[model samples]
Target: MDSPVDNANAIVRRHRLSTRLWHWLNALLLYTLFTSGLGIFNAHPRLYWGQYGANFDHAWLELDRFPGWLTLPGHYSLALSRHWHLAAAPVFAFALLFYMLWSLTNRHIARDLAFRRDELAPRHVWQDIRNHARLRFPTGEAALHYNVLQKASYIGVIFVALPLIILTGLTMSPGMNAASPWLVDLFGGRQSARSIHFLTAFALVAFFLVHILMVLLAGPVNELRSMITGRYRLPKPRSRAVP
Candidate 1:
């Protein structure tokens, strides 16, 4: 007979409280960034490709009139876009910094959250994929914290996407860009940076869609509780399953 504490450990480790808070807060910040970004995009109303970008004649973007109830026009204000973006930047930065620092300090950056040696095995990956496809969940065996796919996605967003977005954002500003010509040099030029920023945003949106789908497939209530409470409820053991 195990005590309550023992049982708790066997089933689920209560997630670190910090993880829960940071996760939701980051979600909020990301939403703000996304909405304000749309406003900014609407202001420009065009997208360009290649080195030499958008001229007045090159209109690759389109916008619809705001609904009459909204009492707005066909366009968004550049000033308002700048204000919202700049205002939200610090909050977004702070949330990311805190999340990264906490993850590192907590020793949560382990093989369990990263890629596992065995995960690269074709057999194992195939088995897991089959289980997921069949709705036969792998609560414990699939990697309780994070599987290889999750780790790769998370790391990419943290390192690649976040940095690219921030730098390109700064590059768009005259004052910031003036102080740092290397920013332009690294990304090729201002228009290039803008293109990169837009592409990265699209990637993130795609990632979010996949993420939400996975969460739904994994059991939304359980996933939501785990994220919110920092604790996941483990499935009950079955007699036929070997330890």
Candidate 2:
């Protein structure tokens, strides 16, 4: 076993090349998709739940158009927005698919992201939550692994949010509806899928904000270095006080 002193000083491989690649790529891709998506939404700020929706159709949720500053082109151009969104969407979806396959083959998912049986226990999860609330972070060897909360969020984004957003995006496509009618049926209808897509996109944005906050709280330099270079210095353990 490595000594604590040595462990604290050791520089270790924290992220895989694939993980870093996808992380940066998504940083760009998601930004484009999101901004452009907001622009597209500006054309119709209302959300509905049936096959058809338009100016006169009743909507389940409605909102004032997102501001120009918050959208792609920084102006109202649905054509340009759709162009940006369409171009980026395929790349983002395919990259996620490839990353999923690669992670599976590399056992990154099983080894890192998979939840342990013990981790799923209510007491264990509650403890993790409490620790996070208190801003307690792992140290030394434990810092090399994700806590339960981290694991859960990563798994949720990878498995649930990303795929659902992709399918919902496809469901909104008239061409896709012709090709895969089941996609629309899966989510109920085009409008329903659109609503889900909108909600899921915001969910991802929420995750990203929380993720950034965690990185900043944990130590931005170390966190950013690990993601960028795949090398991380283990955080030194807190010393026990003499009793």
Candidate 3:
């Protein structure tokens, strides 16, 4: 027999062990990739859409070089930046591949991240949007499953955005280009691929920022604890009045 306090505080296993490991590992790899990438970008702050681009050429997008504090190595070194970026690339790619395969095999994607038909309705989506805007999060058993918006975002990132980034990255690689000329053609050119890569990176960054903000708004300590450990404390259910 559990008291009200005990029941409210009861913990549930939310994430699997493999999912927890993958989450932290992905976080570390993404941090290294982003900082190192910025260091590389500092060397070339302009983006173009063709095979060749230089300081003399006009760029569709341009930004000032990022400061040392914002980059890996903490100094301007294109060579060092490339070294860091390349070193992290294989691990990140492999981890993503492994995670996707594991998730599919375990049916975690189907079980946890899949959206129901009703959730895809315009009315339902609008409701979810309004709920999120109002900071009205799911409680109790509902907390165990991701809301519709969360499912859509996660699916998009995992399926579309991640794969596009990887493909664009390979398109920018000289060795990869040599091996598969089709990649360059697919993206239009190296510079185009670079532009796409930058866009995708920023998209991921935006996602990360929103994710952190949501966690904070939802209860950072509880959210962080769930990811750090497998246990999550569900919000207590609200009582409803009967007529």
Q: Which candidate is the best by TM-score?
A: 2
In the predicted model 2, the residue pairs found to clash are none
RMSD of 3: 3.3
lDDT: worst 10-residue window of model 2: 1-10
C-alpha root-mean-square deviation, candidate 1: 4.8
Tens-place lDDT digits, model 1, residues 121-159 = 889777767765676655443326565456678889887
lDDT of 3 by residue, 31-52 (tens): 9889999999999899998898
Which structure is stronger by TM-score: 2 or 3? 2
> How close to the true structure is residue 149 of candidate 2, measured as C-alpha lDDT?
87
lDDT of 2: 0.92
Q: What is the lDDT of residue 29 in candidate 2?
A: 93
lDDT of 3: 0.89
Q: Over 4 Å off in model 1, which ranges?
A: 1-11, 50-52, 57-75, 140-143, 237-243
Task: Estimate the TM-score of every prediction.
Answer: 0.79, 0.96, 0.93
Clashes in each model (backbone N, CA, C under 3 Å)?
1, 0, 0
Clashes of 2: 0
Judge candidate 3 at residue 13 and give its lDDT: 89
